[model samples]
Target: MSRVAIIGGGVIGGGWAARFLLNGWDVAVFDPAPDAARKIASVLDNASRSLPGIYDRALPAKGKLTFHDTIAAAVEGADWVQESVSERLDLKHAVYAEIVPALREGGFIASSTSGFKAVDLGAKGASVVVVHPFNPVYLLPLVELSGPADLRLRAEPVVRALGMYPLQMEVEIDAFIANRFQEAVWREALWMVRDGIATTGQIDAAIHMGFGLRWAQMGLFETYRIAGGEAGMASYLEQFGPSLSWPWSRLTDVPDLDDALVATIAAQSDKQAAGRSVPELERLRDDNLVAILRGLRQQGSGAGEVILAHEATLPEGGEIDGLPVTASRCVPVTWTDYNGHMNEAAYLELGSWATDGLMRIVGAGPDYIAAGKSFFTVDSRIRYLDEVQCGERLSVTTQVIAAEGKKMRLFHRIMTGDGLVATIETLLLHTDLTTRRSCPPEPEVAAALTRLARAHDGRIAEGCGGAVGERP
Candidate 1:
């Protein structure tokens, strides 16, 4: 198994440990802090509950996590070392000094520094790349990588394997890319607070309730492109470019974070928290992010594409109780409802995908559909058996009831660790996409389906042949 050593055990460090461990990398950590293990454990628990739901496929089994007393003990056989110590040049250098010699052959180190130049970091001549991740590292995919070209090249694929996107910085700069923009926004937000222009809650509302939502999906330029109307980005710039030079006063000035300002900000932030602990807030943030990402997944846009792309790489197909396992996935936040369970419509969506899965199993996959033939659902009956909650993994196993000529029937069992949760019985007709009429499938596909039907003959599916509420 691949191994990673984590230095420090603060928020960022703990997040890194959780990221690596969930991706199935054995993690060794060294931190003298007494609560380090507890902190990492808490992060791991939060991560475990949320991260997998963002994907339609299962992540690999979690890895072993061990804490060590000395840095060397953790670093000795590691394939990669992630340093997330406090943002002190001397402290970082000291950690690097101990890490370099202890690294196994071909091992490298990545610093989770929010902002620090590569030259300054490698001044002591130990090669390290800046791989900065946003908070709640397990979910956010962006990681800014800066260092020598060779070092970055080596790190990029590893990050991608963990389902993260690596942003390569060819030119090293202060604070890297994301934080620079953030610093500008923060400076402006602070000025607004100092000038009493807006309170913390109002500023937050401005973000999540407006531009922040826009930014989350289309981002600045693309969203502006819409504002450009019939024209594109060029028209957008022409219209708004001149306004940027206006006296957007106080940007050049710094806010005085004195006692009053700090107290004002602190009190407002407390109100914003509204009695939810930091961990509770993190859970809320994670749920909203999952919903947004899954929304994007439907359009194959933004971070959803990353997840979709990664899911394509996940292995599929298995059997359960003599039936073919057709669909397996974590219930996304979008799939839940006010009832605190999977929505009724969401269950139909699950059954639809399971039908698709069964198609692939019987020689009717993407290529077959692309060749102008596919199954069209004609009827479906679903019996809801139990509750399915957000983040719960659900698997659908299909038992073919009939497969003759242009008609096929399927009974799907939806299961969780708690046992069978739902059952769907569906009927489908093979169709000619061009003719838009019922038709025979390809010879091979027909034969395969027939064989499957024969194999499943004489088996009893409890809810098979039942209309809704018949209780068959």
Candidate 2:
């Protein structure tokens, strides 16, 4: 879709805008709050690093964002409207009323309300879908989808197009999917504090030290299935089922919000989270999640696998300019090492830089590089055809040897002078940024490659001799 309108430009709305814009969908933001622009800009900055880190490839061009003074103007010609207003029912009703008058009949509306059921909002519009996403929306894949089944069916592909998973809730329920899970854990933790059986630190330690790690890759049921050992989930469930009658859990009981209990929990939580500001904690979380998910992606498992598949559908290098160089970097001073020559890795780095420059030429640039879609080196055959002392000027040239769907054969030559060919030849594959797996370039990108391939057709890469196929 060409344009998406986001209402209530708070954190969730801003995040939604980032995801869509990164995927090449133009966005318009509508919020009466004067600070909406600043909030969205911050969201985009965070996403620039976080989103790109997950994928080995580059994303599509970020779409143009417009700030509309009125809701009507924002909704006009919008293919989708994402609402992220306050959680109160009255506020949502008012926002919905304001939104509906401006929205076209077929335009899709997704509410970012955590607890509100889609049915409540659907009465106002036939095409409304409740799409509640977790915090750090660009990185997190889970999005709860509930509403008219038909509306959800229509909305799922759009959600997928933005590199997110649309989880369908079988029935409309308050708190939807994740919040219900959160409430259950919250209740148990509160009761532990009321009884003085477990400190907040103890509870947090228990989770982060154990289940949290498992949960990152496998959900509760899958984890239990493994714990079942030889028999599987059924055998484990049958063995554990008999213990259900025991008073093992006080999960249903309510804890009074007493001052002493609150203080104890709060103090313990503060101690457990000591020495880290919210932003620092967020960075730590992002780092850990990226590392873990990236590992899983390499293994072709868990959420990493799902994200990998989502990225596969993204365009490799479209008609705009060039293939995005996801691995581009300037030569680092440290890369010179002890020798006067650039380190071997640094040669690879320069080659990557040249490839990126070529990508910009084909059309993909910073904006397209943000969406988790781009190209990756499958194999490289570099020949140190010539080596000169460090501190000399250097550059690289890239040519498309062959382009067929997701696989493109690239030949790169690094040179110290315009006439000399220093190093060359890299075979590449179009990859989904999320999955880090090979995928065919999108049709538009492929078409552009056909032209690029022809332009670079009959030429052989300058240096393709010495032990050429080694990875840097």
Candidate 3:
């Protein structure tokens, strides 16, 4: 039920809006430009399609979004006010001054300014906090928090709630941490282009095809730590320390971005785009990010850990068509095949989780497994009824079939808004984990499964008992 007021509607502002709105914050946006609404809508469209794919559970229900003509109307009763206007000091100061009088008593202003220090930004004595986020705010989890210690403390929970990392800055400096590194690399890249040493495409490939992958998981210093062999970090410093004195990078030099260089860069960038619109390019980037993030999520590393933590806080399960919902989530890009629809293997994975869900309902969850009693799936059959695309929200409902002494049967329907996409019929046997052999379940779990079986007895399942290629 929390509300956020967004001032500005450029790329960064829209991205902030999308992140907060999708995370279930009521958003009020104030942007003077006439096309701001359309721009924000496009960002939201991309965000809604990709952000939730990073998590196992669904994000919170989307909250209300309202556009206002003035900042006062937007900031009234707001829990957090975000200022993402142009980088001009005068403009930001004006926005902050207007925001303070109307901001709720407990609310604070968050500036998306990348380089401004809090001391300068808070000249008006407003409760301003620097919460600069990266491009595509909904997908990138890093947000630099700098300002009043109390205000920064207040912002951490809110940032975590949106599945973002709040990397606190004990000392505020220009451009913060991540962006400073980015600026250094950018300077080097620019120098390379100016020197005619590399084209935009080649430089991009060098990063994406090489160290970028390393950076995604281990980051810079850790990657070098591995490079140090068995000697570790101190050895790394010894090996690379001398190179710092060498003139290897032009980080300190400025490249003349004259018309010729600008033209060359623009032309190369257009070729790289290959006729894709901005939105199209954005979708491609988001898909790649989702695929990479999900892989890292499996390892629980870096930003993937942020996603796992937030997903744990999310509420799970509900009923659909009077059946207990087992697994519900948006299809991630990783689940799709070359044919561009969900692969057959994903259907099996869904069924497996649904089986886990049913076991949990029958008092045989992770704790039961830890206690040495659990269910092991011996066989399963899936009948895919329709195509499922990436980003589609799927709800799986499980229907208990039979719960005899040592065996349990479940039927799962994987559905989208259009209708059922697949049906899974799986059979499991109760097993003692310690012995790794089949066994009868505890009395309570057995009785619970029996109750579910009796409740679903009257329901017809056409796809059950089917062999390969069998049709109902």
Most accurate candidate by TM-score = 3
| Clash totals in order | 0, 22, 0
Q: Is candidate 1 or candidate 3 better by TM-score?
A: 3
Query: Ranking by TM-score, best first?
Result: 3, 1, 2
Point out the higher-scoring one by lDDT: 2 or 3: 3
The collision pairs in model 3 are none
Q: Could you tell me the C-alpha RMSD of candidate 1 in Å?
A: 2.0
**Cα RMSD (Å) per model?**
2.0, 10.0, 1.6
lDDT of 2 at 460: 50
TM-score of each: 0.94, 0.72, 0.96
Q: How do the residues 264-356 of candidate 2 rate in per-residue lDDT, one tens digit apiece?
A: 887887887787877677666765666676677677677787668876765443221232322322232334557755677767766776677
> Cα deviation in Å at residue 72, candidate 1?
1.8
Q: Which residue window of length 10 is worst by lDDT in model 2? A: 323-332
Q: What is the lDDT of candidate 2?
A: 0.74
Higher-scoring candidate on lDDT, 1 or 3: 3
* lDDT digits (tens) for residues 1-472 of candidate 1: 8999999988998988988888899999999999999999998988887788888777777899999999999998888889999999999999999999898876667999988887789899888899999988988888999988898999998888888889999999989989998888889999999999999999889888999888877777789999998898889999998999998856778898999999999999999999999888988998888878777777888888887887787767789988898998888778888988899999899899898898998889899999899999999999999999887888899998999899999999999988999999899999999999999889999988999899999998897886668763
Candidate 2 deviant stretches above 4 angstroms: 124-127, 317-472
Q: Model 3, 1-472: lDDT tens per residue?
A: 9999999989999999999998899999999999999999999989988998898887888999999999999988898888999999888888888988997777778999999988789998788899999998989999999988998999899999999999999897989999899999999998888888998989999999999999998888899999999999999999889999998988888899999999988998898788999878889999999989998889999888988999899877899878899988888888899999999999998888888888888899999988889988999888989999888889899999999989999999999989999999988899998999999999999999999999899898887887788885
Please give the lDDT score at residue 389 for candidate 1.
89
